[model samples]
Structure formats: C-alpha cells, structure tokens
Target chain A: MPKEVAIIGVGYAGFRALTPEVSYKELMYEAAVKAYEDAGVDPRRDIESFVTVAEDFTEGTSIFDEYVPDQLGAVLKPVHTISGEGLHGFIAAYLQVLTGAMDIVAVEAHSKASNILTPDEIMAFAMDPVYNRPLRANPHFIAGLEMNRYLCETGTTREQCALVVAKNKHNALYNPLAAYGASIAVEDVLESEMVSYPLSRLDMSPRADGAIVMVLAARERAEELSDIPIWIRGVGWCNDSFSLENRDWTNAIYAARAAEMAYRMAGIRTPWQELDFAEIDDTFSYKELQHMEALRLCRPGEAGLLVEDGATEIGGEFPVNPSGGSLGMGHLLDASGLARLLEVVLQLRGEAGQHQLSDVETGLAFGWRGLPTTSGAAVILSN
Target chain B: MALLEKVDKNIEARAWQGEIPIQSRYTCGLAGEKFFREIMENGRFAGTHCAECEYTYVPPTIYCERCFAKLDEWVEVGPEGTVQSFTVLLVAPDGTPLEEPDILALIQLDGADSVLVHRLGKVGLDELAIGMRVKAVFKPKKEREGSILDIVHFVPVNA
Candidate 1:
C-alpha cells in the first residue's frame, strides 16, 4: 500500500480585490511563514521539497518558478512548478512524500490578479491563435455557449443558475477572508447586465488577489507535527480535448473523469453519501451546477434542483461552497484550487469559525483551468 | 530592524507599462495545410474521414481522436451545416460593447461529426436555435486567402 499523506499546515493571505502595497513575493512570504509556523517546521531543514503552481502568462514573467524560491525560502532546494491548478501541485507534493523521497513538502500557489491590467486579453491569448483568436470575441462567450448547451440538454433554467450566484455570494458574507461577499437575491443576478445570452455579468466570478501555502508530510511525520492532520484520501486530474472544434459542450467530461479517478482511489462509491460537502469550481454560476453533476453528487439536471431545495446551502444536507467558493472569495487565478482545498482543511480542522458545518468528516475540493480548456483536478480529504 | 513600509499612493509607486516584444507563428501541422488550401482554392469545406472511427472531422485533424488511426481520407463535408450551440456576444474581451451583438455558433457541417466555431449573420438571437439548418457564405473568391475568414459567416438556410 502507498503511504498516506496529510496536510499538517495551511496558510493564506489577501483574498481581496487588490493588494498594491505588497508584491506577489511578499504575498508568498507571508503565507509561507504562517504555514511553516502552523506545521512547526523550519523550511531550511524540515521541508524537503517545494512545489508551486503558476502560469507565466498570468504572472507577466517568463519561467515564474525562478521568482518563487526566494519568497518561499526554498532557495537551492528541490523545487518545481506545475503549470496547472494548485490541487495538481498538491498531488505532486503528495506523490513525492508517498515515494518516501521526501518526508515533508510545501505546496504554494497565489494570484496577483490585480497586477494583470488586461485580464480578458490574457484569457483570449489562451485560445487557438490561428483559428479562434482571429474571430476576436471575448473568451467568456465560451462559457456562455457551454451554459446554453448545458441548460438546453439538461433542462436547467437561467433562474437556477442565478441561484448559485446568490447562494455563494451570500455564503461569502460569513467568510472574513472572502473578497466579493454580498447578500443578493437570484432576481438581482438575473437583472445584471447581460454579457452573453443566458449569462449575465453576475454569473461570472470576478478576479481577486491572494496566496496559499500548504505543507504536506507522510502520515508518520504528520502525526508527530499536528494533532489533527487533514488526510488526503485521493487526488485525480484529467484533460479533455484542447480543440474547440471537437469537445463536449454540455458536460464537463474532464471533471467526471477526474472525480471518478479520485472516488475509486478513495473507495467512495456513492459520493453524495460518503462526502459531507464540496468546494466546487464556481468560476461561472452554471459551472457550479454542471460540476456538481460531474462530481456525481447528483444526477445530470438534478444539481439545479438540489440548489432549489436548499440541499447545497451551508446548513443543507450536502453544503457545497460554504466558504463562498470562487464566486464569493473571488477567483484566485491559478491559486483557486488551493483556496478550495484550504477551506476543506479549515472545515475539517474545525477552524472555519462562522460558516462551519456540523459533524463534517469528509469533504471534496475541485478545480477547472477556467475557460477554453477542459483541464480539471479533484481531491478528497478527511479529518 | 524594522520591515520596509508600504507604498500608499498610486502616484508614488513606480511602474512601467510595456508589452512583450515577441511575434509567434503557429503551423496547424499535418492536417491544417490541406484543409486551408482546399478552402483557399475551392471555397468548399473539406474533412478527413477515419475509417476505424467512422467519423468525419471538420477543421480536420491528421489523427483520429478516438481510435488513434492515421486519418488521410479526404471527403467533401458541407457548405451546409447545423447549429450545435451558439451565444450572442454583447461585449468584447476589453468590456467594450460590440458594434452589434455578434451571434457566434458552433456548427456541425452535414458530413462531419466535429463542429466549427464561427459567426452567424443575418439572423437575430431570437430566430437562432440549436439544430437550425445553416449554410456557409463565403467571401468573393478574389479575396479568399486560405484562412477561416474566407467564409464570411453562416446564415440560416431558410432565410
């Protein structure tokens, strides 16, 4: 059997709209210091390896991994970067410790979204240059197209999609760290200026700046360090076709495959029963509902119904995105997955102060590499 | 020693605004050359057929996604297609309102299993529907340049 890995320490800084005072490096240093302190390990000695999740395009720097070492106190040590989601970085760290090559590893991810002046242009740059870019429409239109298909095929409604925005933004009201927390209604969401048909501006999660650092260790080392270590039961990631010409528009096949791999590894047959709650990707409102079905938390088209029944509310049976998700906390670029994972750890550790769910044990966190890409990662964590 | 204090004002912070000085050229690789050349020369849609998968791909690829078979069978796809999905763009990526709301659709040409992302013209958002029959409207042959823009837009066949 593979050795188990657990997150013994987690730290984060600035889930806010802007942070002009401190640079991205300072953001990393602040979060790293707290995470190392929380785990009671000195980075130079106890931490054996480092993994960071970043995209050079978002960072406006080439080979962003070079700039991370100094801030993370990982200078000259074994360090690498995963260009995908932060949870993917977690999996890399987890596998490293499982290999027994490293007893302790630190995983870091952050968003300096405020630094990027043209967010949409950056997203548009990710499209197929020869084919899609020449058309020159906003990238969010892809989400809108998918939303139209998902709603049409699944019989989900625009009102149901709006409920997701209302629920997550309301849930964010309880999270002090959340950036865009607000108490709004579904009708308000529907009334927001339409960016694309069936997708109003409110349906999309705004950008936020933040950093998160997590320290993982082998079970033996984890138990020695902390009384309550959040065990990583399973982790899975997948990528569907990158081409828009041939890809599933209605279903998130990538999320389903990722979730399947995670569920099989964690030996979870019926996810809605085995897992207490989830922090699903809510980059767009419809995405939350689409991902719920993809995660097998509900049947196709039933995710919107679950929201209607309050089954996904903080006090509800499944309680997804109680930490306000990316919608409430602000989409943290590449760090978004780490933010989701951090909430799971906090809830599992009973550190989620106000919005904490009762008697929760197992929780899930998921991430999608935002628009125009079908890359996704899923992880199951238990206290 | 104390830590460095924070910079408070936007005027006080020193920063430079410049874009990366790099130009990139991407080749569509094995299949794209044939696909675009056919469009440039004939103003007709061409797709590659995979015998194993028994599916034709528009904006054809050299390899079959499902069976990993080398796809070289060229077939005439369509000047006619069906709308698979569509969206009306109200704003540009820079958050500027478009001159007119552009209707973009993913169209599955009659002979191909895969879809092509393109614009729809001469149709209102209310009139457009998934599965609506549409036909490609190419630019005048004199202006054809082996690019996707060679086809001006797709329009509802009935209209």
Candidate 2:
C-alpha cells in the first residue's frame, strides 16, 4: 500500500509590490517560522528533508539553492532545489514521503520579483536565442499571440476575457493578502493600456515579493500533527513542446495532461461535479478561462460563458480563485503554485476566513510556469 | 512587553547593485546547421519532413517530435505564408515606445506544419489580419549572417 501524503501546515510572507526592508532570505525565514509553528514541528528536529523551488536567472544568483537551506533551518540536511514552479517542489516532497524515506518534508518557493528591475529582459533571455530572442519584444507578446488565437478558435470575446479581470480583481477586495484587489468593472479592464493587442495592462498580473512554505508528511504523521490536515489525494505535472512554433496556441495542453494524470489517481470522473472549487493560474485574465477548459472544469469554449454567467463567482455553483488568484494577489513566480495550493488548503480546512466558500470538502489547484514554457502542475486536495 | 519594534522611517534602506557577467556561444546543431545554411546560401526557407508521420517541422529539427524518427528529408517552404496570429506592441522590452508601434506575427509558412514568429513590416495594425498572406523579405545577401534576422521582416504578400 502506498503511504498517503497530507499538507499539515502552510505559511507565507509578503504579497506586496515591494519588500525593500527584507532580503529574500528574511522572507523565507519568516515563512519557515510560521510553518514550523503551525505544524508543531521543529525544523531542526522533525523535518527530514527540505525542498525549494527557484530559477537562477530570476534570483540573479548562481547556485541559488545554496543560500536556501540556511534560512529554512535545514542546513547540512537533505536539502535540494527544483528550478521549476512551486507545485513541482511540492510534488518532489510528496514523492519523498511516499517512499517512506522521510516522515516530514518542508517545501518552500518564493519570489523576489521586486528586486529584478529588468524583468522583461530576464524573461527574453529564457527564449530561444537564435529564433525568438532576436525579435526583442516583451515576453508577454507570446501571451498576446496565444490570447488572440484562443479567442478566435473558441469564439470567446474580448469582453469575456475582461470579465475575468473584473471578477478576480473584485474577488481580491475581500482578501486581505491581495495586493491588486479592486472593485472594477469590465470596462476599466478593456480601457487599460494595451501591452500587446488582445492583452491589456490589467490583463497581466503584477510582480510581487512573497515566500510560501508548506509542510507535508505521511498520513500517520499528519494525523498526529494537525487536527485538520488537507489530504493531497493526487498530484501530476506535465511539459509539452519546448518550442512555441509547434505548440497548440488555442489550448493549454500542458494543464490538460497534468489534470488527467492527477484526476486518474484521485478517481475523479467528473471534475466539475467532484471538485468543489479551484485556484487555477490566472497570470493573464484569459488564462483563467483557458485553464478552466483545459482542466475539464468546463468544456472547450464554455469557460468564458460560465464566467459571464457568474457561474464562477464565490457564491455561484463553481467558485474559482476564491482567494483572488494571481491576478488579485499578485504573481509570485515559482511560488505561484504553492500559493494556489495554500488557498486550497485553507478553503478545505474551512479556515479561509472572509474569502471562505460554503460546503467545500475537496478542491483543486493548478499552476503554470507562465509564458515561454508549456509546463504546468495540478494537485487535488481533500479534507 | 512589546516584542516588535519598527525600523525608523528616516533611515534609508540600503541595496547593492551588481550584475552577473556571462556570455555564451551555441553550436547550431545538426538540424540548425542545415536550416540556416539553406537560408544563407539559397535565400529560401527549408523544413525537415518525417515520412512516417507525414509531419513537416519549421525551424527544422533532426528528429520527428511526434514519431521520434530521424528526419532526413528536407523540403523548401514559405517564402510566403499566412498570418496565423499577430500582436501590435506599443512599447519595447525596455519600456519605451518606438517611433512607430511594432507589428509581430506568427507566420505559418507554406508547406510547413509550424509557424515562424517575426516582425511584420509595411503593414499597419488596422490592416493586419489573421489569414493575411505574407512573404519573407530577406536582408541583402552580403549582409546575411545565417541568422533568423537574415530575413529582415515579413511583409504582406501583395505589398
């Protein structure tokens, strides 16, 4: 029998535009302290492994993982880093506990996006040098291209995409941790400065400084540690073609594959009916609609209509991103996945104070590595 | 007793400014070598074809992505193609407006399965539309350096 994994604790620090007073180390340390306390585990004594998610280019440091263990209090222990998104780190920790090699594991992901002054340049550096890089446009141009194709193929209007921005931003107004919270109308989003055609300024999530730490343990260890442990029923991740030239711009094939693997493991036959809510990637407003269809929460071309009908609102039949999502809370880069998982955990535990939804026992969280990469992860959580 | 104290507002936050100096040289692999050579020597676009899967890859690759078979067949594709998707950028990567807004398009070159992303010249945003035919405009042969930029930009086929 496989040992089940549960998230016993979650902690985070800083969801603001800037955190000039604290270094990335201090941010991680703050989150670590909260997580250790919430899990009632001493990192020095109980944590058997540590995993962090970060990219060297984003951190502006080579071998960024070397600086992570110290703040996490996992120094000289089994600590490693995943140069991918936060959910990838979570999946790594989940596998560790499943192997019975570790009883309790700490997973950390953070973003010091405020520190990078030239984020667009850094993003361009990740593009294919001989081909895409020479174009010299902001990386969001890719999103613009994808968004236009998505709308054209699906018959989704720009107005429907604007609804997502309006809804998510409004939803953020109730979330204390949200930095971009607002009660704006769709017209406001439509009128925002156009970054790339079909993608406006409001369509993009702003960069923020934040760190998230999650504590995962085997079932028996979890029951002993926390009264309300959010069980990680299933987890999956996938990467499609690395080249945008060949990728399907109309659909999030990566999210679909990842969701399929996770759903099969969780025995979820009907995602819309089985899962109560989701915290999906909304780095771009149209992405929320696209991911919904990709995750099978709705049929192709139905997500935009569902959002327009208020079906995805907090009080509606299916609530997505009730914690305000990346658009509302701000994009945390590698930590974005963990941020979604954190919200799902909070909602499942009935601890999502003001942003709480009723009768939620099971939830889903999705994460994408954003533009220039067709990589994504999905995690299913149940209380 | 108070456990927290606030930092003085008058005190300035200190930060260090530095950059990692790194440069790289990439070998245009077997596939890239063939693709770029054709562009540099022949002034035309070429793609690799997999007979088993009947798939043509633009920006050619050595092996078929779908069938994993070695793609040894080369076919000339797209001096002309259709615009599959496009975007007009109001600002550059450095956060400044160009003298004129730039039009970028993903051109699905003729006889290829994939699209090439490049700038669209000689067309305004209002005039550019999906399915609009466009043709690659290469730089002067002497100025060509076997790079994607060797083709300066793609312009409307009629233009």
Candidate 3:
C-alpha cells in the first residue's frame, strides 16, 4: 500500500503574465515564506527534504536544480528536482515522508516565462530538433491539430471550444490570482487572431511567471503540525515517448494509465461519480476536455458535451478549474501542477471563496509536463 | 550632436542583427531487434508488427509498449499518413529558419499503429482539411542524412 501524505499548508504567490518588478529568486522567496508561515513551521528546522519541479530548456538555465535550494531556504538539505511539476516533485517527496525518510517536505515549482523576450524562439526549441525543427512550425500547430482531432472525434465544434475560452476567461473574473480575466463572448474568441487552425490566440494559455509551494508531511506528522490536513490518498504519474512519431495526438495514454492507477488505489471505481471536483491541466482549452475523458470523469469523447452542458461550471455538478486553471491562471509550466494542487486544498478547506464548490471532500488534481507535451500526473485528495 | 547621430546609427545596427544560440538534446529511443539494427546501420524508418496484438509501430521498437515483450518482425512505414491534424506556422526553430510560412501536421500513416509528425507542403491553412490524403516527400536518398526529416515534408498526393 502506498503511504498516506497530507498537505499541512499550501501557499501561492499570485500568478502574472509578467512580474517584471521582481527577480525570479524573489518570486520564489515570496511564496516560500508564505508557505512556511502557513504551515507554521520554520524551513531551517522543520523541512526535512525538498523537491523542486523545473525543466532545463524552459528556464534557459542548464543547471536549474543547482540554483533553487538557496531561495527555498534549503541551504544544505537533501533536495531533488523532478524536472516536472510540484505534484510529480511532491510524489517523490511523499515517498520520502512515508518511507520514514523525512518528516517534512517542502515542494515548490515556478516559471519565469516572461523573462524570455522572444517567446517564439523558446517555443521553437521545444520541437524535435532533427525532423520537427526543419518544418518551421509554431507550437500552436500541435494545438490546432489536436483541437481539430478532438472536435472530429467527439462530434464537438469550433464554437464549443470557443466557449471554453469564454467560460474560463470569464471564470477568472472571480479569481484574484488569475491573470487573464476578461468579459469576453464566444464570438469574440472565435474572432481573435488565429494562431493555428481550429485554435485562436484566446484559446491558448498565456506564458507567465509565477510560483507555488506546498508543505506536506506524513499523515501522523500532518495531524501533529496542523488541524486541517488534506490527505493525499493517491498519486500516480506516467510518461509516453518523447518523440512525436510515437505519441497518439488524439488522446493522452499517459493520463489514461496514470488516472487509472491513482483512482484504483484511492478506491474510486468511477471518477465521474466519486470525484467532487477536479483542477485539470488546461494548457489549452481542449486539454481540459481530453484529460476529463482520460480521467474517466466522463466517457471517452463525452467531455465536449460535459462542457457544453455547464456540468464543469463553478456551480455545476463537477466543478472544474475553479481557480480558472492554466487557461485563466498563467501557464507557469512546472508550477502548473502545484497550482492545481493548491486550488484543491483551498476548495476542500472552504477557502476558495468565489469559485468554491458545495462541500467538496474528494477532489482530484492532474498535471502534464508539456515537453513535446508527453508526461502527466494524477493525485486524489480528501480532507 | 555628432555623438547623438553615431549612437542613433549604432542602435539601428544593434536592432537589426545578432545570432542567439539555441540548443536542445533529444535522447529518443528505438524498440525491437530489427529496429535496433536499423539504427545501428544509421539510416531509414522502421516499424514493428504484432500478429497477436495487431498493432504496428512506425519508428520501430524492441517490444510492444502495450504488451511489453520482445518482437522480431520489421517493416517500412510512411513517406505518408492521411492528414490527421495539421497547422500552418509563421515561424520555425532556430536551426532551420524559414522566411516563408510552413505547414506541419500529424500523419496517420498508411500502416502504422500511430500518427507520425511531419511537415506538409504545397498547402495553405485555408486549403488544409482534416482528412486530406497526403504523401511523404522524402529528402533524396543521397541527401537522406538519417533523421525523421529524411522525408522533408508530406505533400498532397494525386489521389
């Protein structure tokens, strides 16, 4: 049996399209201090181990792992970089906490996307250098292709996807931390600048700089530290091949397998029935729907209707992305996972005031590291 | 006044030119024995077939990622897939800069288990369709410098 892990405290330094005023280290330090205070523990003595989620290329810094410890208050503690998301980083941290390796783990993830003056140059680097690079294509091309396939397979339409941009951007209005809140209509989204076919500029998540940090401890350790402990009931992650030649663009095999493992372990036979709410990885509008189907929150190809029917609305049956998700929250890449995890804790604790669902006890969080966009993680949480 | 003119001319020169280095590493893997041998020979695309599972892999593999075991057979895949998903791009990666717009799409190859990523040509965003039939246009055998780009791009074949 996987050992139980609990979130003793969660902290967020609000996301932004560009936090030009603060240095990357400063952005992380602000969140780290809040996390320590929220957990009511000192990082110097309480944090037993640290796990950081980051990617080398995204940061434009090769040894990103080396530079994080100082800002996170781990001068010489055991730290491991998962090179992905806070959930994936926390997955490893949970193991450390449960295996009696460590009592407290500080998990952190952040992005400095705005620092890259040429966003296109950064995106172009994500392509497969040999075969993919020569094509001279924007990363949005992949989003467009996936969107087209998602529509064709699900019997959904472009207008429906436009609604996702409208709904989420509108949903951001209530979220103080959200960076892209605007009162926009479906027609407005459809009319926006086209980045790729079946996708518009508004359909995409903005590249932004932000940070999220959460402190987790063993179940017993969590109870000792805080009155409210959001137990991590299940954690599972899987990776598909990196090369585009191998991936199935229509669906996420990694998500399907990871969700199954986490759900089964959490004693959740039917995610749609058992899961109270989910903060899915919606780097693009379609991913939320794709991950919904993969999570089995809805039957295959049924997510489009789920969105169209208002089932995923903030007040709906299965409220999704009440924090406005990546579509509303900035896509801080690796930090995106922890952002979802943070929102889950907020909702379960009745702290998410504007987008709170009705008495949510069982919540699910998922993360996908967008490297040729193949890796994903699913964690089941309950208070 | 003289210094201002010199500085203004320098700013224009700085604005127009500079080469920035962009590097990335891709440690992609190949599966299966025949596929492994093809990589050792350093040329071409290979596929794996499973009669029991009835799935074929385009870039070849030692075992089925589905069933997880060793497989022996190999075959040639694409130079084609009917266009499954496509997008036209206004920019290319650092290594291969393009002055003209380019089209890239996922091709569900004729006899492969999954779609392969490739470039599409002679196509505009307006002309591209979901189910368009296209053929792989290979970089000449002499120019076939061993990569997924061996086939430069997929073009609309005369159906």
DockQ top scorer: 1
Q: What's the TM for model 3?
A: 0.87
List TM-score per model, in order: 0.98, 0.98, 0.87
Where does candidate 1 clash, by residue pair? Answer: none
Candidate 2, A42: how far from true, in Å?
A: 0.3
C-alpha lDDT of residue B28 in model 3: 54
Q: lDDT tens digits, residues B1-159, model 3?
A: 001122234234322223458555655554533443453354445788876788887756667777886867877766556888777654344423346666777887788876777778877667788889888666656665455556667788863
**Model 3 over residues A1-383: C-alpha lDDT tens digits?**
34378889876664988665566777788888888888888998989899998877666677888989988889889987887766789788877887888889998999888666556666667776655766556666777777788888778777767777777877889989899888888888788766666777777888678888889888777888888888888889998876676677778878998898898788889888888999989888888888888888888788878888988888888888888888887788788888888889988988888777887898999998864578898888898
Model 2: clashing residue pairs?
none
Candidate 1 lDDT over A4-100, as tens digits, reads: 8999999898899988778888888888988999999999989999999999988988998888898888998999999998889989999999888
Q: Quick one: how many clashes does candidate 1 have?
A: 0
The interface RMSD values of the models, given in order, are: 2.3, 2.8, 9.2
| Model 1 residue A79 CA deviation in Å | 0.6
In Å, residue A176's CA in model 1 sits off its true spot by: 0.5
Docking class of 1: medium
Tell me which of candidates 1 and 2 scores higher on DockQ: 1
